[model samples]
Target: MNFDYKLFEMINQFAGQNQILDQTVMLFSKFGPILFGLVFVWLWFSKSGKKVDNRKIVLYAITITVFALGVNKVIELMYFRPRPFVTYAVNLLSDKTSTDPSFPSNHSAGAFAMAWALFWHRKRIGSVLLIMAFFMALSRIYIGVHYPFDVTAGAIIALIVTAVLISQRRLLDPLYQNILQAFRKSKGQKYYRNM
Candidate 1:
């Protein structure tokens, strides 16, 4: 706990000194997940003649993120870890005031899940997203919203879940294929194809 507090203080100390960097991090931390998710959706549904394997990767990533979030919720319910702002006098940059449990950060979980998913298929884009995800998690800590351990645990969970999903393709392939078949039969097929 002391180490977590010291690290949080060290990171949060940088928030108030630079206005531009602070604002940039704030915006990215607040909306980076959405942007990444939208990018994945666009890649999944875009009619760019990309292989279906890529789309499958996106789907698996999305599924893993959603599942990991659900697991986070369950863990939150079981153990209530208060946010940094609630527990300590820290430099808070963002205006977010939530009483949610801070043991496992949803933002970090989702970001890392997407990062791992994308990295599994598209190396370059995935690497960029992975860096972005790491910064996003750091921003959460820097903004005094989460502890280092919370984000670290979230990241570990995301990686474990992603690895499991990627490795167990035999069980997942048929299920995903059925979902894709249903999607193809739907009316939105005109907007996206080849999967």
Candidate 2:
């Protein structure tokens, strides 16, 4: 309803200092969702060289995609919060892209969903992803698109979804594996046959 000017000014000041960091924030703010999605798809489907475990990849992708979409839609419908830039007197440094409601940032939700999903498979990769997700969340605030609470809610939602998915991995693994096999077969690729 109302903007928190003190918090906004703090984030704005933090974001205003470094040109490279600002550009990084802007770039991720604009394309991080698409880039992360592409990375998920590629990790799951690519048959070029490495023998990636298809089962884990598919499960991660499914978990992240399903949870991100469900949480985003529910929060958007329930909260309908305005973007920070729309509600506050802040200098929006990034492009005004996206018309979606701001509470529980979709970007942060997606990033954390993907990060936690990957964490289930590979600890190192998941650590990197988690770090990336953190930055992505900060970028949403830094660029004046979302508030700290929004990003925090998104991260929490992602963690909940990931926990549920991981707990049900036993039940879901078979179907996910089958889907991955079908995908590999469709591509006429044997990259993951050994795995």
Candidate 3:
């Protein structure tokens, strides 16, 4: 009983079965990260995070996503797993699909990393983002490009990275604050010298 393959097939069986559903899932698969990125940008400057350091939260989220992508690439180089479309007959959504190893999905890793980082700072907003993150992971399986386990592994990588970064906030805070201080000095902010 190959549960990974079986679950992947179950989700992928719906691929190409309907045009509208396929397009909807494809949107999540392809654009979810960009949408989340937009959210981060909006949150960065918004006044809603009055009680929290909004800029730091968004910066950490961006850093986590970048690091998760690097981890995914390194793992791919060390151990390869062919995409579902390569190993089996699949209703693949794109002819321009990636030929890279697919043990852990880059999209899933990036999306989940960003989402989880946000969630730790704002529980309400994070809950919604996490649900969207889950859907994005499922979209990868539904689109027939990745196996179930691939997205699962990506998500696990995201969780670990987000946790480590969030837990080590004390170490990262001073570095970011110093960067901000330098920026203020370069920009000639009047209050720069007071700090």
Candidate 4:
């Protein structure tokens, strides 16, 4: 892979001036996925007056997680590309200590998976999450942690997973609903009484 020194220099200059941007990048890289998962779980458990189907949410989460893992594994094993920091000697403005394989970034995959999964449930929130995921991918490139190709591949994988999950939703919906019903029954939760 050819390195773009000019692009790298520009990004490094931007990182140098924007300390907050670097911190935000790290924060999102570390906790964004966790935050998204927590929101999903919270929405699943809340017994609000609205008809929020816990089963659908659970199904979406599970499917997305599984698919993202599969895509990440395949790309990592097949590509085996080294990270930019691993390839060259450079002082980055952002912390450059990552051991993960560089091709098809896991952060991008996870972010997209959560964003797409939540999109079906909450359009507004999902739209915001999608934008966040895009920026996170860009940050990975800016920080020299990932190549542009890696982010591109990750986005494609995420799209495929999201499409498959959406297509199979009908078949999985009943099983998901049954599982939720079982959980509600076991807990003796009043929310399931109407069901």
lDDT of 3: 0.84
Best-to-worst order by TM-score is: 3, 1, 4, 2
Taking the tens digit of each residue's C-alpha lDDT, what string does model 2 give over 1-195? Answer: 235556756787777678898898899878887877776677766674444473466467666668776978987897787777777676578766566898777788888888888777778877888898898888888888888888888898898888887788787777766777787789898645566
RMSD of each: 2.4, 3.2, 2.4, 2.8
Candidate 3: give its CA RMSD in angstroms. 2.4
Off by over 4 Å in 4: 1-13, 47-55, 90-96, 190-195
Q: After best superposition, candidate 2 residue 179: deviation in angstroms?
A: 0.9
Point to the candidate with the largest lDDT: 1
lDDT for each residue of candidate 3 in 29-59, tens digit (9 for 90 to 100): 7778889999888986687734237777877
In model 1, which residue pairs have backbone atoms overlapping below 3 Å?
none
**C-alpha-based local distance difference test score of model 2:** 0.76
- Give one digit per residue, the lDDT tens place, for model 4 in 74-141: 86887687777777754454464776798878878877787877776778878887888888777777
Query: By summed lDDT, which 10 consecutive residues of candidate 4 come out lowest?
Result: 49-58
Quickly count the clashes in candidate 3: 0
Model 1: per-residue Cα lDDT over 1-195, one tens digit each: 899889888899888898998899899999898888887888887776564666787888889999889889999999999999998788888786898899999999999999988898788889998898899899999888999999998988899999888899999988877777677679566433443
| C-alpha-based local distance difference test score of model 1 | 0.87
Which of 2 and 4 is the better model by lDDT?
2
| Candidate 2 wrong stretches, greater than 4 Å | 1-5, 16-18, 45-55, 97-99, 188-194
